[model samples]
Target: MSDHTIPHIGAAWREVVADLFEMTKPKVVLVMLITVWVGMALTPIGAIPWLAVIAGNIGIAALAGAGAAFNHILDEHIDQKMARTHKRPVATGRISRRAGLSFAGFLSVFGFSVLMIFTNALTAWLTLFSMVGYALVYTAYLKRATPQNIVIGGLAGAMPPLLGWTAITGHVMGLPLLLVLIIFAWTPPHFWALAIHRRDDYARAKIPMMPVTHGIAFTRIQVWLYSWLLLSVSMLPVALGALGGIYALSALLLGARFLQWSYWLLYEKKPDAPWGMFKYSISYLMILFIMMLVDHFTWSWLVSIIFPNI
Candidate 1:
């Protein structure tokens, strides 16, 4: 091939790689990884296994990416009809369904292998269940079946902390379960804000998202209610003595901001309020988990300094 043709071929390959990466929904995968880190970190393991932590996290990310790719294949038709998702790689035919499926299969096998080798059988199995939960159960059935789809489907997305904890301890524990509960309670408000923003797209696609099925006004009320619910659930860790004062204070402050945005979305009804809430919710969850880690590590040291006599 001529030099000019070689450059053109390289550019084409680059574009193809980018498209494949897009199918994995990297942004969502990133959030999953952060929660997983928090889960593993909060475990009471005496010595950290850095190698397993790194390898297992890579495995978890791969599985998450695989699930997202599967979602691209299954939701292509719905994605094509929705303005927000119409330009997705599968929907746009930039990557065919068969290619997407093969990619997902590869990721699933690779991720499961890595987890089993580096982590444990339990972690591997649990991660696989989460993949199936998201890719097959939620994407294929629940999403199209009911307006409460996200509520039920939220468990899959919320499983990373448990998976992370199990990777370290090879079993379930109360703290990890509490972490899962926080995410589960947070999902509705987080998603409903986006659904309200994209209500027209969902309506056009005939997807029964909360705003589409129940009306935006009703969905807004649900968002408001769920925000309070999230705040309440967030306190459970501290109440159970699993977390500390630092995390409790962080939760209250972060949750207050979430409630503030939710309040605006409900009463103020600014056209941009829903989008603002959607954006903030993402940051809120990430920061909340990071604070949990911070609190977990530093609380004893701080208490010792504050009350030297005690």
Candidate 2:
């Protein structure tokens, strides 16, 4: 191969890989995995199944990626009409619709196989359900059909921690449900913040996002309402004794900050970019889950020291 040809080949290969990865929407998958990992770690059970943790991460990432790819394929037309997403691989024709569908199928099959093999059937099934709910239901129908789309579709996105818990515990539990509720409540404010920032993009695409459908004021009020509810829901775990002071304190403080941000978004002078709350919402969930993980280990260590034996 000629030297120039070699660099061309390398560039082509990099572009191909990048397009494929972009179809999966890896940034969203990262937060999903963190929630799953934290849920796995915080399982109150026998010695941690290290294998399940590793396998669960891989499986969840694959399925989440698959679902995102499916979304790309479904939303390509609308994506092209939006400033924020016009350059998506599928939208821009870098990845063909047929190719995107194939990739999504491959990821789903691989993820499902890994989940069934490494974890339990229930975990695999639940993950599959969430993926389908997002890719098929949310992306295809809910997004176009209603302004309340994210609020309802958020259930699918909120399942990760529960998936993680079931991977390790082989059964669902109350605490994991609490995790799901917190995320479900958080998703609205998170998404509505971005929707406010991108309301024009949504309008251009003819998608009925909250800000586009109900107007910015109504959407802003919804963000505040959901953020307040999220703050209350986040405390449920600590209140019920699933978590202790460290986690509870952290949840309260972080949630207070989230509410404060929501307040600014709703009440303060309008800014050029209205995505401040969107950025903080992501960090809020990540840190809140991390606090829960830390609380679990801290409690475990204290118990081991204080009790020493039954």
Candidate 3:
């Protein structure tokens, strides 16, 4: 090949590779991984196994990526119709359906295998179930079916914490469920804020997002309500004694800010309010989980320092 032709081919190959990576929705996968790590960290397993934790995290990331890829494939038509998603790899035909499917299949197999080998069968199966729940049940059916799609579909997305817990302990029980509940309660407000901002995009796609189906005014109220619900649910860890004062304080402060943003979204006339709330919600969850990890490690020391008599 000519030198110029070789350079052109190399650049084209790089673009394709980048597009493939984009189809995996790396940002979402990253957030999920953080929750997974926090879940594993909070588990009371003595003499933690760093190697298995690393491997388990890899497996969960792979599974989450595969689910995202499947979503890209399934939502191509809907994506092409929406302005924000019109340039997506599958939507724009930069990645073909066969290639996307093959990539997803490879990830699913690799992730499940990794979990089974390094974690345990329970974690592996639960991860697979979550993948299918998102890729098939949520993306394919629930998304197009109703205005309450996110509320219902949030379960699968909220499983990462529980998956993390099971990865280390090989069991699913109380604390993990509370962790899952926090994310579950947080999901509706988090997603609905974005849905409100992208109301027109979902309208154009003919997807029945809350703002499109229930109207933006009604959706804003729901966001406000769910924000309150999230605040309450987030405090449950402290109440149940799964977490302590540090995490409790973090949740209260973070949740108060989240509630304030949602209130602004509800009452304000500014177009940017919804997007602003959406961004804050992401930070809220991240910081909340990090605080959980911090409190998990430092609670006893902090309590001793503060309440020496007790």
Top-lDDT structure, candidate number: 1
Clash totals for all candidate models: 0, 0, 0
**Predicted structure 1, TM vs. truth:** 0.96
RMSD of 1: 2.0
Candidate 3 accuracy as TM-score: 0.95
Report how far residue 308 has shifted in candidate 3, in Å: 14
- Candidate 3 lDDT over 1-310, as tens digits, reads 8889999999999998899899889998999999999989888777989877988999999999999999999999999988888999999999999999999999999999999999899999999999999999999999999888888999999999999999999999898899899999999999999999999999989889989988988989999999999999999989988888889999999999998998899997566999999999999999999999889879766777899987
For model 2, residues 64-91, the per-residue Cα lDDT tens digits are: 9999999999998999998889999999
* Model 3: CA > 4 A from native: 300-310
Best by TM-score: 2
Task: List pairs with backbone clashes in candidate 2.
Answer: none
Candidate 3 backbone collisions, by pair? none
Per-prediction TM-score: 0.96, 0.97, 0.95
Q: Which candidate do you rate higher for TM-score, 1 or 2?
A: 2
Model 1 misplacement above 4 A: 300-310
